[model samples]
Target: MIKDKPIFSVKNVCIDFKVGGKNILSKRSVLRALNDITFDLYKGETLAIVGESGCGKSTICRTAMRFHSPTQGEMTFEGKNIHKLKKDELKNYRQKAQMVFQDPFSSLNPLHSIYYHLERPMKLYHNFSKTERIEKMNEYLELVGLVPAKEQGEKYPHELSGGQRQRAYLARVLSVGADIVFADEPTSMLDVSIRLGILNMMNDLKHKLGKSFIYITHDIATARYVSDRIIVLYAGHMVEWGDVNKVIINPRHPYTKLLIAAAADPEREGKVELPIVRNQESEVTVWTPDSKGCPFRLRCPVAKSECAEEFVNAKQVSENQFIRCIHD
Candidate 1:
């Protein structure tokens, strides 16, 4: 199903942030949010970006949506550079690419009813007649499992439960006719019971509707459940990537194994995984834009002396496993 040229692609994209420019005394510092990150999203495919906190999972989504221009490299949708698009072209790009934010509470306007939130996108993109917009809104709300669609559509976002608000947001994205949806941990705030339902709904949307999805999350389990492919990030560096199950079951990168080990399954009551120890010297060498060698060398348990000498290149260790590390 992932055949043909990619629908969206990020090639060697790097993003840098200028922090602290408020006063003359406060010198601006460069924080690299992404480093030569690259990946492709095919139609009907789900690509998951996974890492611990601050590993730049959310940054990738922002870059693809053109919220932040890349300091280096490029992002393209249907072969056109997003960073260089004109205002009109950019508006069209916005309609085609939609985002489901992490926070359900603030994502919807408190002032507007849920119907208004859903109808706005329909009117903006589809030029739907007043009656048509109402009918479509009801259909979408029902699609997301909000039954008695007409009644549910009229409630304010605050009136809905946290789960319902998320469903409404999903309906809004569908209402706009977006081809790609960037889900930035959309179900992280909900209860465990509710999370499963949301995941099922997203799965239905992906396979049934053939929408491209970029699912960003720190939860490795969910990443495996939702994504066809997985890319693991560490301190802004792409440490590992390939088929989701392959990487999850047999992680090659030291940082990746550490992350998986942390997400132990209590269901496997007697199963055990060894702890990954950190190199003490690495604790003192903080990773920065200018850090030499592998960005993870300092903390990597298997790091060798040569690992600190030059930039590390990613290698294909198995059929689908690509890892960036000094040692095999």
Candidate 2:
């Protein structure tokens, strides 16, 4: 297998939202959605971001797509800084990277037909003739397994089932010639049995088409199934990241272990011990520039007094395995 280079690289990327507050002493404050997040997306591989709901998985996806600008750090695409791209350049970059949103029904336009949805991007980016655009639309529909494209294209978003609507979304991405797909909980809203089908399609796309993907989900099992590498995020910081099998079988971080513990094994009939849940908001007293320590220290079961100091950077405990835990 060819070791394809990183098509997208995010270096210490930070995203902060200015939330409103009331108090004479309070200045306009920012909520750090993503804190010093650094990761790379290699070609033809899936890098799954697994975390709880407010850990900023979606923010990372949005930042990479240029939908949300980072407050700090640099994002590079094909070795060029994406944050500095001009309007036309950004538009061209967007054409190559597409997002498959969680809710299939909400992603598509209720008023437009599937054909119109697929045709719009092709028309906007490529200077194809009407006949060429229509032909390409049919080809994309077929590529996403929405065959009999001529008839399916005429149906509206509501006319299709959840899985079908998601397939339509994939067709739109294919229509635009996108090589990287950022799928944010793509199967969360679908029926449990059909979720694997969507994941299998993504796996096929990666192997068959050499397309890269970022699969974001809270489900650890799905991450292991669909991703080559897994990144475990907690409260806006990466706790552990490495090869999927390594992390799943031998989790290092407290949070990662908690997640693995929570997930029940389908092969085993009886229920397993549930993982302990942490209060996200109470995990830390504050994010102080003066403070230096592991971000997960407050919630870590094995925290020592030494953990109160600045936590050390991630260490490679084994080949292809890295965890940002002092205990590890």
| Cα distance off (Å), candidate 1, residue 133 | 1.9
TM-scores vs. true structure, each candidate: 0.94, 0.91
lDDT of each: 0.87, 0.85
RMSD of candidate 2 to the true fold?
Answer: 2.4
Residue pairs with colliding backbones in model 2 are 292-310, 293-310, 293-311
User: lDDT of model 1 at residue 123?
Assistant: 76
Candidate with top lDDT is 1
Which parts of model 1 have CA positions greater than 4 angstroms off? 21-26, 270-287
| Stretches > 4 Å off in candidate 2 | 1-4, 22-27, 268-271, 274-291
Cα lDDT, model 1, residue 192 = 80
